[model samples]
Target: MGLGTGQGLHYETAERLSAALASRTICSVELVESLLGRARTIDGKLRAFIALDGADALRQAVESDRRRERGAALGPLDGVAVSIKDNMSVRRWPMSCGSRMLDGYVSPYDCHVVERLRAAGAIIFGRTNMDEFAMGSSTENSAFFGTANPWDLGRVPGGSSGGSACAVAAGLAPLALGTDTGGSVRQPAAFCAAVGLKPTYGRVSRYGVTAFASSLDQVGPMGRSVWDVAALLGAIAGLDRRDSTSSPLAVPDYTVALGRERRWKIAVPREVFSDGLDGDVRDGLRRAVDFFAGAGCEILDVSMPAMDISIGAYYITATAEAFSNLSRFDGIRYGHRSKVAGTVGEVYAKSRGEGFGAEVKRRIMLGAFVLSGGYHEAYYGRAQRARVHISNGFGEIFRNCDFIATPTAPTVPFPVGAKTQDPLAMYLSDIYTVSVNLVGLPAISVCCGFSPQGLPMGLQLIAKPFHEEELLAAAAFFERNHDFCRRHPKIDQ
Candidate 1:
C-alpha cells in the first residue's frame, strides 16, 4: 500500500496519521478525501458503512485544515477521520441502527462521544452498520445488509459492531466507535483482526446512544492497534453532565501507556475452555499466555464457576432491559409506523412487528417474557442474582491477579450462515465475553493469532473496574512485541 494514495494511507493507524497531519506532511483535507475515495471504491463489497456524506466530511476537513494553519488545532486527533456506529446520534445523520424502524429518522443532536470527537476536531465522516438494535453476534442480523469479513468475504464478521471492525480491518478508516453491551465490540474486533475495547459501564457517557441494555451498554473505540484505540478512547472519554450513568471519575492520558512495560499476574480461567471452544482458538489463547509469560508475567490458573451460568443470566437480564428500553420506539412519536394499523394497539404491534428484524423481535419477545409477572422472579431476578455472583467472583479473582485472559470468542470468523440457523449456537459465540459485561469491568480484544482457515483470533485481557489505563498498557505491551497486530487483511487483491 502506498502512503500518499487513499488506498495506501487506508492502513495507517490513527496515531501515525495524526503525527503526519500535525507535522504538515499531509493536510487533513487530503487525508479525509483520500479515505472517502477509498470508501467509495471498496465499501461496496464490505458494506461497512450505512451512510456517508462526502460533502459534509470535506467541509469539516477544510475547517480542520484552516484551524491548523492558524495554530488553533484542537489536539492530536484534530482532522483524523473516524466512523461512528449508526446507533449513536450524530446531528442530521440517519441513525438507522441497521434496522428499518428508524430508516429516515435523522438525529437532531449529537451524542456525548460525538460531541467529544468534534470538540477535538476529529472528522466524523460516516455511520457504520450494526446488528439491529445491537442484539446479534454476527452482522447478518442487520436489516439492511450484512458486513462481510475482510479476511475472507464469504465468512462473517462478528457483531453488533461488525461494520466498525470491518471498516478498520479493510483499511476504510483508522478508528471507529462501537457499543459493547456484551462483547459486541471485542468479539467483532477479534474476527476482523483489529483492536476493540469495552470500558467499564459508567466510564463513558451514554447520553445519546440508542439504548440496547441500558445497564450494560458502553461506547468504546476500535482501531488497528492498541495505541490507536487508546488515542481514540482518550479523545472521547470523560465525565459528562448529560448522562446520569456517567461516572465523575477523572480521565487519564491513555497514551502514557505507550512503551511502558510491566509484569502482570494474569489469570486463566478453566471455565473459558469449554467444549464449545474451537481448537484453533484454544491454541491461540495458549500461545498468547506463553507470550506474556516470556515477558516476565506470572500465569495463574483460576476457576470462575459463575461463568458456566453467565450466558443464561446475561440473556435474561439483557433481554429484560431491552424490552423496557425499546418500549419507547412505538410509531406514535418517532420511528417507522405501520400503515396497516387500525387501532392504538395495532399501531404498537404492527409497527414493531414490521420495523424490527427477526433477531430484534426475538429478543424483544424474550425480554417481555422474562419480565412477565410469573417469569420475572424466576428468570430476570435470578439472572440479576447470578450477575452479582459473577461480579463478586471477579472481585475476588482481581484481588489476586491483575487481569483475566481468555479467547475473545469460541472460534474464529465462521461462514456467513454457519450459526444463524441455530440461535443457541450463535449465543455460544460470546460465552467467553459476556461475563465481563455482567460485572461491568474494562476489557480489550487484541489480535493474537489466526485460525488454520486464516481468519483472525483474539485474546482478551480484562481489568478491574476503572482500570482502563492498566488494560490498555497490557495490550500495548503485547502489541509492541507481537507480529499479529502488524498484519493487515489482504482485501484489495
Candidate 2:
C-alpha cells in the first residue's frame, strides 16, 4: 500500500495522491476513508470545516472504484476528496458562507465548478468555514465558526478563504476550492502555508458562489503544490454559459504546458520589492528570480506608476459592490430572522444587527456611506478612476513582460488577533495582492519560505487574464528546482 492509504492522510498534494491511485498502489476507497477520517477527528482543533458528508464521500469513492474496474473514463482527479469553501454551492449541501443567517440553507444545484469536479470524479467531503458572506480579512468574522491556523491553533488561517486554506494545509484534504475577492485566497494561503490561485476574473464561472463583490470574485484552487493547483484549475476552469462574466477563451492544458513552455520573460516590479518587506521575504524573492534566471529565463525589472493606489482603490470598489450585493440577505428572504421582532422592518434591522459580525457590519455600513449621494464622488468615483490608472499601468507593463513575480505577502502571518482591532492595519497586509484583483488578472501564492517565527511566507505570481498556464509554469519550475517548499513546521522541529 502507498503511504496515502493510511491512518492520517494530511500534507500530501492531490496530484501526488492521484498519481498513487493511477499506479494502483492504493485504492480510492482506502484514500477517501483515511482522508474522511481526518475530517472527523483532526478537524476539531483546526476548525477548518463547517460540515461533513461522510455518506456522500463514501458513495463517490465506491463509484470511482466501480468505474476503474469497468475501465470507464476516469478524470485526472478521480475520487480525490476536496473541501469547498462554504460560500460555494454544491447540490443538497449547506452553503452558508459561515453565518447564522444561512444556518440551514442548502444549494438546489451545483455551481459550475462543483459540476466539473463531480464530472471529474471528485468527492465533496464537506463545507469549510469562512468569513461571514466572505466579508473580512480573517475568519474571525464567521458568525458561526472560526478557522484556526493549522500551524499554530492560536493564529488565524486568513480569510474569507481561511477555511479552505486550513483544510489543504492541515491535511484535512489533498486540495480545496476557494474564492478570491481582494486577497481572500492568497492572504489566507500565505498565512496557512498553502498554495492558492485566483483565476483572472471571468476565467472561472461565478454562477453559484455566494457573491460578495460581483466584479472581483473568482473561484480558484487551494492545494499543497503548484501542479495540484494547476491540475485542479484545468478541471474547473474555462468559459461557462451560465455566467455571462466567464471568459470566452479556451482553457489551456496547464499541467502539460508548464516549465518553460517556450522561453519566457518574467517580470519583477522593483517598487513591490521595496522596503517594509521582511528580510526573509526579500531573500526568498531574490532566490526565486535567480533560480528562474539560471534556468534560461529573462528576469526584468518593471514598474507601474499607479500601484500605490491599488489597495485604496480596491477597498472603494469592493466595499461598494459588497454593500449592494449583501442587501439581498434581509430576514424575510433566505437568512436568519430576528425572533423578538414584530414589524418587518424591525425583523430586518434586528436580524441584520444580530446575524452579522463586527467586520461584516462595518464594511456594509462603510460601503453604504461611500455609495451615498454626497460621498459617491470623493470616495467611490475617485476609486474607479484610480482603478483605471492602475489597470492602464498594468497593461503598459504587460507589454514588456510575459508575467510578474513578487513575494505573495510583505510579511509572514502575524499572531492571530494581531491586527483584529485595527482595520486599516489589517487591510495593509494585502498591499501586494489586491492589485491583481483590481486588474482582473490571474495570480497565485505558493509557500516560498518560513519566517524566523517558523511560519510560512508565500511568493506570488501574476499572469495576464486567461494566462494561468504561464503563471503556474513559472511556479512549477520554481517548485521542482528549489528547496523553498520542502520545509514546514513539524512536531519535532
Candidate 3:
C-alpha cells in the first residue's frame, strides 16, 4: 500500500515500515507526509500532539531516503518517524511538560534520548501532550488541554503519557516515547489498546527527560505491537555519561527475543485481584491466565503482602522527589517570571502561584509537607523503608517465577471528569502500576481483552530488573496468538 491510498501506511507497525523503507517500496519522506496529513485531518479531536515541525521532519526524512539509496542506512529504525513526549528536550523545540510554568521555554540542547534517536537515524517529528509536570493520572490535568481516548472520545486516555499513547493508538505515529514514573506509560497504553513498555528504572537514561520522581522516572517506548516497542527500546536503551543513574550494562537486541519457545514460570499475585478491581478487568486477567496455562506455561498464585501498601508509599516518595526537583522553576531562574513583581519574594511567590496548574500545585505541596523537618522521618523516611520492602517482596517472588502477571489498571477507562472531584479515587487508578516503579523493575502492558462497553483492558507482565528481553518475549508470545493488537479504533476523518 502506498501513502496516496492513506489506508495501511498510517497504521503500519514500525518493524514492518522499517523493512519497507529499506527495500525502497516506500520512502521515509512519503511515510512522514502521510502521517502528518492524517494528524492535520484528525488531531483536533484527539489532541495528541502539542507541536509539529513539518519542515524539520521532512528534512530528516529526505536524508534517510538518501542514505538508503546510497546503501548507508543506519539501522532498522533509520527512517521511521517517532513521536516524542513534550517533556524530553528536543533542542529548540518547546519542552512544555504540559504545564504553563515553562510557557515559552525552548530546550537549548538535546537530551540523551534524543541524541540516541538521532544516532539511530530516526526522524523525530511531533511533540506529544502530557499532564502538567507529569503529576496527574488523567490527561485532564494538562494545562493546555486534555487528550481524548481514541477508543471513546468522552473518556480519558490515561496520563501523564496519554498523548503519546493516543498518538500511537490513533495512528498519528507508529511509535512514540513516554516517560513512566508511576504507570504513566502502561496505564494509557491499556486504556488506548496499544502496547507500552516501562524498562527497568536505569535501563533507559533520564538525562534529557523532564523528571517527575527522580528515583522512579523512566523513559519508555509505546507502539501498536510488542516488536515495534522492542525495536524502539533497542535504539534508545544504553548507558549515557550525562545521566549517572543510567546503567553501564550492554544493550541487547530486543527483537531477537520474539518467538522464543520456552515453558515459562509465571506468577499471578493474589493482591492484584483486590475488591477494587472492576468485574470486567478481573475476568480478563483470568482469561489471560488460562491462555498461559493452556500454552504449557506453569502459572502459580503468589502472595506479596507489600502490594497492599504500594500506593501510599509511592505517593509519599514520588511527591517528595517532585517537590525537590520542581523547586528550580523559580521566577528568578529560567522559567516564568512574574510580570507584576514588586520584590524578589513576591516574584517567586506570584510567578509560581500564576504559572503552575492546580494539580501541579497540589503535588508540590504534598511533597513539601512530607519532606518538612517535622514530617520528614514520619513520612519520607518510612516511605523509603516501604520501597525497600516492596523490592524485596518482588525478589522473593522472582526466585520461583520468571514473570508476574496482573491487570495493568484496576478498571477500564473512566469518562472524563468522572473521578476529578475525588483525588483519592484518582490516585487509586495507579494501584497496580506504582509498585513496579518503586521496585525499579521492567514491565509491559499488552491488550488482553475489551470491556463490556467495548473499551480495551490490558494484561501487565512484569520482569526482573534489566530482564526486558524476557518481558518482551512473553508479551510477544501472547500477542501472536490474539487479534487484539490488530484491531484499531475507528477515527472520524
The TM-score of predicted model 1 comes to: 0.98
Model 1, CA-based lDDT: 0.91
Q: After superposition, how far is residue 490 of candidate 2 from its true place, in Å?
A: 2.6
* Cα lDDT listed for each candidate: 0.91, 0.82, 0.92
Rank by lDDT (best first): 3, 1, 2
Look at candidate 1 and tell me the lDDT of residue 46.
Answer: 92
Weakest 10 consecutive residues, lDDT, candidate 2?
484-493
Off by over 4 Å in 2: 5-8, 261-263, 491-493
Q: Which tens-of-lDDT digit does each residue in 1-493 have in candidate 3?
A: 4533537588899988998898888999999999888899889999999998999999999999999999999999999999999999998888899988998899999988889999999999799989898888888888999999999999999998999999999999999999999999999999999999999988889997888899999999999999999999999999987889889999989999798967899999998888999999999999999999999999999998998899999999999999999988887857799899999888988999999998888889999999998999999999999999999999999999999999999999999999888888899999999999999999999999998788999999999989999999999999999999989999873
> Each candidate's TM vs. the true structure?
0.98, 0.95, 0.98
The alpha-carbon lDDT assigned to residue 128 of candidate 3 equals 90
Model 1 regions lying over 4 Å from their true place = 1-7
- Model 3 is weakest, by summed lDDT over 10 consecutive residues, at 1-10
